[model samples]
Target chain A: MSYSSQAIAKPYFTVAITLFAVQVLFGLIIGMQYVAINIEGIMFDTARLIHTNLLIIWLLFGFMGASYYIVPEEAEQELYNPKLAIQSLWLFLALTIITVLGYLLLPYATFAKITGNQFFPTMGREYLEQPTIIKLGIFAVLCAFTYNISMTILHGRKTIINLLLLTGIAGSTIVFIFAFYNSSNLVVAKYYRWWLIHFWFEGTWELIMEAILAYIIFKVTGNREIVEKWLYIIVAVTLTTVILGIGHHYYWIGVPEYWQWIGTLFSVFELLPFFFMLLFVFNVVNCTKCHSSNKALKLWALSTPIMAFLGAGVLGFLHTLAPINYYSHGTQITSAHGHLAFYSTYVMIVLAIISYTMPILQNNINNRIVQKLEILAFWLMTVSMSFMVLFIAVAGIMQVYIQRATDLALPFIEIQNSMMILYWLRGAGGLVFFIGVIIYIIGFFYNRHLAVD
Target chain B: MKILTKPKYIYYSSLIIFICLLLGLTIHTIIVLPERDHRDNLTPQIIQGKMVWEENNCIGCHTLLGEGAYFAPELGNIYKRRGGSHGGAYFIKAWLKAMPTNIPGRRQMPQFNLTDEELHALIAFLKWTSEINTSSWPPSEKG
Candidate 1:
């Protein structure tokens, strides 16, 4: 009942840590599958969908936990109810379990029945075979999360940042609902599906980025005024960017002709919030005169916002233009952007929160060592993931060039087969990133006994 | 005493720079948009072909003048892209008439069963699209 240091943060920490590990591990398997012919007797085609989907689910869970921990702090009140929070968590957990089980059980059989004309082992089926029910389950879970977060925010104090956060969550809810209707009709459904995916990427996720960056800035600098200013800038810029930035996804789809111009124009502006975020965080860190904290911790906290901005913002800019994206859409190049921008901004923010809170819970060890290790892990993983994305993008570009050069149609399989070198380089990058994840995981648990008072 | 740590000027300056960049980019795009080009001689065949294309949803599967779904290749310059007019009206007519050809592992294009007259009209529609001044999309003849 007390809002003191005795509050149990261990469970949240445990969930975050476990999800991070699972994400990194699956990420590595997906990476290796790119290069290796037969890893665990599964095709790369089937493995990748699972890998990306799993990464998205786990990361979303981590983000939810981070938000749950922070909203109460910002409000200067205990969570509206810990029981409700736990209830939300259980619903998400149940839904995820059911979905995964269905994916493993029903999907393979369906794939075999449809394509292979026979039954096969359940665990070995292609990912696309999963029933539409799994998608429905995911939508339900998203609704539950939206309701919990909305109710919590309603009862708690409302700041600009929290309100923006609520908006992002609300947008996510709408997008999820839209996603459920995606298979009803191909023409309208395809447009709406892009609305969910593209809007989530270019719109609501932009707001989510702002909220995370604001929280990180507040924790690190203790300058609420500065944080608030940047938050406004981020939200304003992101809204403008996403509303039109959606044109980027529209280019390939059978959308209206004018969307190409609109998407390209807005995407260019999307870089603005990112640039502001970088300037804001670095300026804050530079102005700080205190050295009482670990240099490693300080650096990690200082760098998270900036990196998120770069990963999602600058790298995202590389192929978003209509001219370049016309060639690169649905290729490995787009995948590269998603890998870096999504992981860097969202994943780092979650970890940054974990780094901040676990210490407050128990400061029995030196902060510097943990901070240093965390920073080290951050760079190691980020660089590797960046390499994986870039290599694949280049390969994709090369494939497109070669493919279009021939008047005769080339097989998609042949294109994939020829890009073995790029795949290996990508796999190598994943391995390096996994190594970093292991380092971070070790540092996380070790800090339990090792924080300084 | 307190140390004068806050740089009010720098924050304001940073804000100014961001605003300038936005205005600059928007203006640049407007300036770079290609001037609209018009074609003379409104032929009946071309008009009829365009009607055929629209009614059959050719734009759903193919891009022409960079103004359609990209599910298929850009046919805006297909006359030159195929290294001959071989892929023009006659070739397109045949292709649409017997699409999907039972080719395994290839995306099947739908057969519209357009009459010879309609096929010729659709071909004329595509040829007309190819003739439009698009300032060179796909960046190559083969595209």
Candidate 2:
């Protein structure tokens, strides 16, 4: 690592990758449960709770890791306070561990009771299920992280990437506080919940992702001006589209009818950014004629936007309209889109950065064993996930036809039962994905000069 | 592309303008939300039931508003599908009381041992949820 503070990303990456592994393991169990493999105590719900929560946590840690590594290098300076950053990370980890353990050891209701949820009542929201205390801890950690990054940028060279990343971090940190404002009215609760969900996932998080992608593309292509140029366009398209695109979610969620038009019209442009992003990556690579021997980095760098386009752009567009989504909203189509979107958008970017940084941090390049494993892992994950998404999509289509579109609709249980074959196929894909994760994890350790977990 | 490459201030200004416009729309949302959701109908019992639903993390298995886990049927409309149509609150109560059918190779729900009071509250919650203005989602009762 160039700066001493950058080395702290090691623990952050460790937490991220480890949590990613367990998240997929839980995902595997959830897949099996769909195909009649009964996991008693954990069940489908609890396993899902753990799975989704782990995903959000690991991605957050990955973002933190990326910010820590990118800031000092971009700023041409060390961190504002290495000691405080380290302390903040430790506290963040401790609180997250406690939250995960609580989700496991204690029953849902029991855990809520113990955490004094009645006082604030923030527990059990989707993706925001952490206890009230854990929520406060998360806010504190975010404040520390935001302050650290902001101060670092303030003290050093402030580039476009640095400014955008700061805006994203600060915006998401602010959005998260909405989780604490609970309302007894379900519609009110769901209404404001989208402010956090849509704003972060589509708006702010894209800023962070684009900044990181631009950083990598520029590093590889040595084309700062071009990369920065495309970065602004991608970001501009993303916000203008996604800001109004939040209406797509509001359409059927007890919101006003104006959303029906507003959501659809705006979401039509949602594909622009992902498309532009794909173009940006390839244009830079071609412009610079990248002949890097780091095949793994090349693989991750290219796949990041391609898969994001497929997942978040195209698949998302399929259901973005109100009429189509009316049938597909709660079905497996959403699951299909959600899985691919999350995997490609956040997970792949994180992996891309890790692959690029870890070797350099440990002062090694292109270890044959690590190279082969990551490439193989990349293909395995991509192919299996594509299979998984396809099966789920087919099942979702069939489900819509049989369960919703038909004159005589079948019951939910019967429709689910009919999709056993697709469920089995999805489970198979999950098994392969689990193996891919294990392989990826093993590659991290095989580096001879390994310094980070 | 040339304009984009020339000045960063232009891009920053556009972002700020878009955000301000979105905020303007959000105020309209805030104004209409209380009426659109029929916030006045959210009774104390319904609120209590909501707390119970959350406390148990019901969203873990059952989707409330086309959101949450898809393992179970959407519970948001349960009040209309079962209660208002045929079965009513009694059926919901029996279903809750019936813990883990113990059917081999079938997904199971844990028994929460909810009190009679909680059961009534949960029914009230579902009833309120059914009445929300979801713009007619799910296409059919299959949800």
Candidate 3:
């Protein structure tokens, strides 16, 4: 908010939250379809594609918004090019809209053909399904974004946080080049895909998350030395553990058997950074004399590390071992882990930053009513998502037992039918989550007439 | 304060240890592990079949080698299940040709209306996939 260029982040944050609401709506639809059984026309796969794609796109939007806001402040400069940032935002939103509409309207194959996927043929493979042209467009956008941020850093203070964030952004962009490497060899294809997925999430994204969290803690506690020291340790652990953690996905893919041992042993260490994050946040909060009146931000800041530990750290360990994963692979257990991990780690961090920055950007302390509603939204979203995680974990455990563990194994459909009640419960949780999102959005516009603090 | 003021060597050494461990493990996984023999012999038809699978977005519904969606049964071992004792590619082709049984009140796969050539290629792809070492995944043929 110190720089006029930072205001460009406002549109990105607004759109990100809006898409988050849309993602939750799709979650409810898919959750309902799980139990209803008779709901037709919209296949579970179709809903799932939308759900997963929106999750990725919206999170990207959130990250970009965060970069726009954080990079300038850390660099002590205006954005390198605010106009380019705005253009990138619009282009990204437009492409996302067109891509989503295509997914909904046309058969995936026809859509692929229409998007010139036949030329390179990188359509199906999970999460990297965007057409080759769109992928190129994304690459272009990322280059522009990286250039803008990097130039600003070059012109101004090059703090560790900025350097780390830049490394993450640049590293992820480079890793994405492998998305186009859709070899016919599934093993080779999966190997490259993890270079994008695992490296981004566990490797680079952790650096980005840590940098941002460090920024927030510094702002709150004015403890630069302590925060920066923790940041270094966290990044070190992350780089060490997550690089090898990619082996976990290699275990079941057509890779060699050694990945079984390597994946499990390395993945066990992947939880350390998240655990350190929990300690970092709480320690900062405890030592700080200055309690920034933004209780909502403080709440989000605190929730992130704790929830991330439970979701990504503890639950990830539960299935990281090869023996357990053999049964849990591709089951709802992964889904449960995924839901909590992304929510706690990535989603909460984004929301936390937005909550902290939005008030400053508006040049006001939020009115009491707005603050109260925002806190309410926080509880509603966090509690309901936790419930969603619990219900899905229970569903996953039951599925593993009945479908894989038991002497008399059940068919997938029969087991799915037996888990209808849990699906219903999950759907209920989704409904509550949707309500929380709506409340969170409404809190933004409420009390607009009140005077600024 | 003492913890924060500790010499930088401890931190640097910890980082060094981490990098060494990661590099060692990565090399073991990528190079030391021998390649499965079947992978070195992929034919043009099998490659084409994999393209067909990707183009059609079959992974949206089916799990291949315990990857992809779990909405449908795992197809990584479909050849073993359909072929029974002797793994034949014919059953897979037949099954693909006769999809979307449109059964009442059950999940159904939409028919892609693949050409004969595409079907052949897809079956070949499945056959090749079945032969690759997946570390004995899917737990059983029930997948």
Clashes of each: 8, 1, 0
- What are the fnat scores of the candidates, in the order listed? 0.02, 0.78, 0.57
Worst 10 residues of 1 chain A by lDDT: A118-127
Off by over 4 Å in 2: A448-453, B1-9
Put down candidate 3 lDDT per residue, A1-453, tens digits, no spaces. 688898887788888988998888877877877776545567666677778888988888888889999999889999999999999998888888887787777888888888888678888888877778878888888888889989999999987778878988887788888888887777778877888888888877877888888888888888888888888788777877887788788888777787788789988899899988888888877877855888888898888999999998999988879999999998888888999999998899999998888888777775677788889988998999899989989998998898888788887777777887888898899899989988888887653334354
* DockQ, all candidates in order: 0.05, 0.73, 0.50
Put the candidates in TM-score order, highest first: 2, 3, 1
Best by DockQ: 2
lDDT of 2: 0.87
Model 1's CAPRI class is incorrect
Give the clashing pairs for model 2. B83-B88
Instruction: List residue ranges in candidate 1 displaced over 4 A.
Output: A1-10, A109-137, A288-296, A363-369, A405-411, A415-417, A448-453, B1-143
- The estimated TM-scores of all candidates read 0.71, 0.97, 0.94
**TM-score winner, 1 or 3:** 3
The predicted structure with the larger DockQ, 1 or 2, is: 2
lDDT of prediction 3? 0.82
**lDDT of candidate 1 over A300-336, digit per residue (tens):** 5666666766777877776788878776654556566
